[model samples]
Target: MVREHQYEAARFLWGEGAIERMGEVLAAAGVDRAMVVCGEHVGANEELMDSVENALGDRHVHTYTGARGDTPLGTVETGVETFEQHDADGLVSVGGGSASDTAKAISVFAAEEGRTLHEMKTQTTDDGESHIPDLPAPKTPVFAVSTTLSAAEVSNIFGVTDEKAGDKVVILDEKIRPRVCVYDPAATATTPASTIASTGMNALDHAVEILYSDGHAENPFYQATAEKAIDLLVTNLPAAVNDRDPEALAAAQLGAGLSGFGIVGGISINHGINHPLCARHPVSHGDGNSILLPHGIRFTYDAVPERMARLAGALGVEVEGGKATDEATLEAMCDVVRELQEEIGVPYRLRDVGVDRDDFEAMAEIAAHDSAMANNPKRVTASDIVALLEAAW
Candidate 1:
């Protein structure tokens, strides 16, 4: 068998006080004036914001607190306007996935003048093939300070919600990838425990989906990183989320960062389903991921049983005599995931997270068109998605 893969490497500064080096990182990236992008909650954290401001000092031009969950297109436009008005040469994205995504979208939208996000996004053909357009513009650099396990900073792709269409639009541009990433547990301490726990599941979903994704299944780099990510998250997430242990949180943060490496290899049905759920409804990305992960694993099992079974060891499942059938391993894996969710106190069902059963068909239809769905190991139809939603419900 022959396999080939490519990945982009970004400078990463991680540890207890990694964020203190923000000014130095910006200087190295040649960013003279920087804008801090964050959500209302993160922006309102006086201590955290003060630290960030103090670190950036004169380099910090403005703090945009309009970042919303789900990375709304409207918010991105507003952020782009703010970025231009402040004369910011770069962005420092603070908080979870939404803030990171918002900053990335702002960079692209700012660079690609006279174009809307809808015009720059991936489109589906009449025959159902995904067409991702080339974005050749040079985007403003982004320096990400991740505060959750969603790990959106490392990927070159970002999803923005088109409010009118009520669908998530994915845009891919290598230039929008963060120039540097800072992961400090101290920064995440201010985030809610439930948010941390749910996003940790979202990280786990990234690892699981990569291992079984048709495009990534044969890539050794993705396989190694994803396996290690799963191990670290499984071991540390409980302590990190429940007890708020800094050391444990740091370990989980590393897991989330490692999990992000596999994003270049591609994600599959899990994210395909999650994208629409978060876009059209009031669902958080992490909660949607948590609720859908087990069902996704089960759905892709038959197509990639060996790949799925390999996760047993990663999930800390023990076989009776060193070897068990894939079926047994599959059940054990799902059970372990459920137990982890329970220990972390995250919702386990779609209904528990305010997902309406009546919208399953519509969500499924939107999900079927997501680019990630094209990478599923098993062939997935909108009807299959509806059935999965029914089972999850």
Candidate 2:
């Protein structure tokens, strides 16, 4: 059995006033020439950036808001070249996962090194299976600013998109993790409600899947956090998406980060299966996870009924009286997902999101073969995944 080790430690901000700490870090790290990597659209928030600049005045901050959706390799490479041209000292990513992930790629590429990020482009599952990129030593610090509730900032991993292959791949390493995460609720307010809803579901699935993972028995601490994350999401997400209530936004940001920490500690199959849907259909990560959630939960329920019951209850689905049986409770979980989706403006079925049924088989083959499948809660076959895809379809 593999032993669990909680080896990540990164600073986080919950309520308001965290922006002060964000400034403190920028001054402390003294990032050579801090590049604020965000989406080009964010340029409209000049007042916000000016506010941050005032806070981080000590660091010679530069702006590089270009990459959106997927963290492109070309973007990262170009950004690295730009950073070098400007003699940038460090990175300050102020978007969602893509910008931060692109920063990680830049940090790796720009560090004082022999290998360059180019050498690390192709990775195998295992470190020994392939050569470790000629990584630079004591690489540049990467500070993150999250404008969304998706907790990718807290995890010691980066998700990148290979546009050439239309696939997402993760760069999981402690070094890639952020040095600090600045969470300003005001920042999230600028994000689209639909984006908020998508990431919320992804965060929700993270909480749900972790509670039932085979590794759950081994990592009790995170299980508690996962359950609490689910509870917070159930009560707070609708409000966050519906009204952008300040309190709700605060709760969601904190909950999503906590859940992210838990999920990274051990994600198992849901992520494994969800990756293909996102990769194959160009579906947004959060929406893809949301679309597959109930089905994924249902499939895993047979192996961990009690856990599913807890999830069902956490989702605010009453699992009482007639629902005492796992079957009823499990179905109720699906209802809860649908309710949440509708509440958050998500479509009831995959077709609404433009996922084609014709490609289900092909996606299933990739999903079943995905590396995450090896540690899934329930064993999965290509056919089983195809069936689940059909059900979600």
Candidate 3:
């Protein structure tokens, strides 16, 4: 059992044009000589760069524009090299999960001055014990400008891909959490609707998994926040996707941020299943979650029916009976999630995406041993994981 967990409470700023205030916040935090880590799209936009330069004003800025999905280890080294070349004192990550994750990895490497990237990578044992190094010195701070609902901006931990092993590596350190996060709906305007919709599902996965997490029940604060995050995400995701309303977009961003707050409590089978699916296939993280969520909920619902009922209520599903059986309530919640995915045009079945049937057994084996699976509300075996993958297919 986990006890006395800590939450990363970064200073959050949100609004329509909130990103324009980056210069003011940076100056107040006494940060100068900052390195900007961005995605290929944002990195190439001269207009966006102008805005960034305008915000930084006279502060020294270095740009590293090589972030990609699944934060590659080489990208982290590149970001560190850029930071050192510019003598950067801080970082500004401008994109979604990949960009923010790269910045976090850079900070981790920066702290251990002489350590190689491979040496700094986290190592996990068969028993799930992780050997993470300690950073006694204050590390460089990161300021995030979020352009998607992925919510990596608020996390203390980030995932990087190990090219040699062909697997994802997760790193944890509170010092990697961003010092300031700017959530401007306008910034996400240039992002594709499909990407936004898919990432929203990823954020939804965070909230739902936290609600059913074994560790979350230990913290009433996390419970309440998870519920609120669920409500906001369910109501706003479709609006943000279909209408493209700035207000709805802002609300979705806030919902993503709130969902991240409870993530330290834990994740569940949905994430466990999706991580391996994404790793094996080219599927986006959110799309994989969107596909596997209903199946994951059904697998765990029998163990925690009352909580499933509460979650169904939060999603505004109309329960047929006030005293509906746990099984009925569980089915209802799963249906609601499926309906939302369909409405938002996200893939609801693994087959609808490019997931290969031949890979089900292999994916399940990997998912069974994933680090996130430890927090699942119900005990899961390799057989159970394979069954879920088959059902999703």
Candidate 4:
């Protein structure tokens, strides 16, 4: 067993009634100026914004509504400008992962030294990596009011696609984690059913991958948390996707947080293969994972059969008997995932989402080298990734 202990950031308030407690944490953290982030496309929930404003009394409260989908360099700069223009002391993120990720990038850029944004881009880090770090020092605290079930709050990690570089970059550090995660299920009322389903599926992949990850045996706490998260998401996500009921939404958000926390700590091959899908194709983050998850599970069956069996049960597939062969268990589990994707309207094949064979080799090559690939349960080769892509195709 390989054990490399890791610490996840954020003080969280999960479940119902958590949103009301945001003021206390904000006050305690000494956030004198708070800027709440939202996407320009996000419908203004004035009442909720007003409530947040009222909660942080005697402090400057502002709305930042420029975050758009796709984390290109342009959007990153816009987010950074929003922070510095406001001279914000506290960052409160609203909307989904795009907005949340944008907020984190803004904080990163704002903390950097005297290098202008233009100079920063041309100058990669000393390690020959792209993008300049927040080299000067730390910036203000980040607080997230997550309306969607996709957990972007607890993790210090943020995923952005460098359009110019033609790849998605996941930045990690303790500073990027939200100081507090305010989960208001009511805030999710307006999210499209499609978005909910895709993101929920992504969360499921996170939890499941971690369960079959490298250090699971040596890290009981991480493995246990991941197991529970998978259980909760599989139990609640379908209802949350189908209906907008407040209770169901709350349950889904809670499950998402659990799963998000799990994957943020450790992930595997599905994302290694799926990231390229999102980068090159016009697929939602969750749908990208949904398309690849079953195949990933199939790939790992020989290595982690028992855990795969449990996933099968959580996904509502009958195992016939616990004594069944691992291959049989794996087939049953993949079938369960396939059926759920069909039921929830997530596309199970890349063809259904309009991906063609023209760039299959290119995509596979990038996936095999992706940082996520290194943490996979089973060591993967470019050919293995190509095979999975062909299966999905």
What is the C-alpha lDDT profile of model 1 across 119-170, one tens digit per residue?
Answer: 8877445464668888888899998999899989888888999878888988
Candidate closest to the true structure, highest lDDT: 1
**Tens-digit lDDT string for candidate 3 (130-181):** 3565656578989899889998898887877766654565666788799999
lDDT of 4 by residue, 84-155 (tens): 787788887877888788788778777764544333331223232234344446767888878766676667
Candidate 4 stretches greater than 4 Å from native = 1-9, 14-17, 113-136, 215-217, 306-325
In model 1, residue pairs whose N, Cα or C atoms come closer than 3 Å (at least 3 residues apart or on different chains), thus clashing, are none
C-alpha-based local distance difference test score of model 4: 0.71
- Candidate 1 positional error at 72, Å: 1.0
lDDT (C-alpha) at residue 43 in model 1: 96
In lDDT terms, how accurate is model 1? 0.87
Would you estimate the TM-scores of all the predictions? 0.95, 0.87, 0.91, 0.87
Q: Please list the Cα RMSD from the true structure of every candidate, rounded to 1 decimal place.
A: 1.9, 3.7, 2.8, 4.2
Instruction: Give the 10-residue window scoring lowest on summed lDDT in candidate 3.
Output: 121-130
lDDT of each: 0.87, 0.72, 0.79, 0.71
State which candidate, 1 or 3, has the greater lDDT: 1
Worst 10 residues of 4 by lDDT: 121-130
Q: State in Å the error of residue 131, model 3.
A: 6.8
Clashes of 1: 0
What's the CA error at residue 61 for candidate 1, in Å?
A: 0.7
Using lDDT as the measure, what is the rank order of every candidate, best first? 1, 3, 2, 4
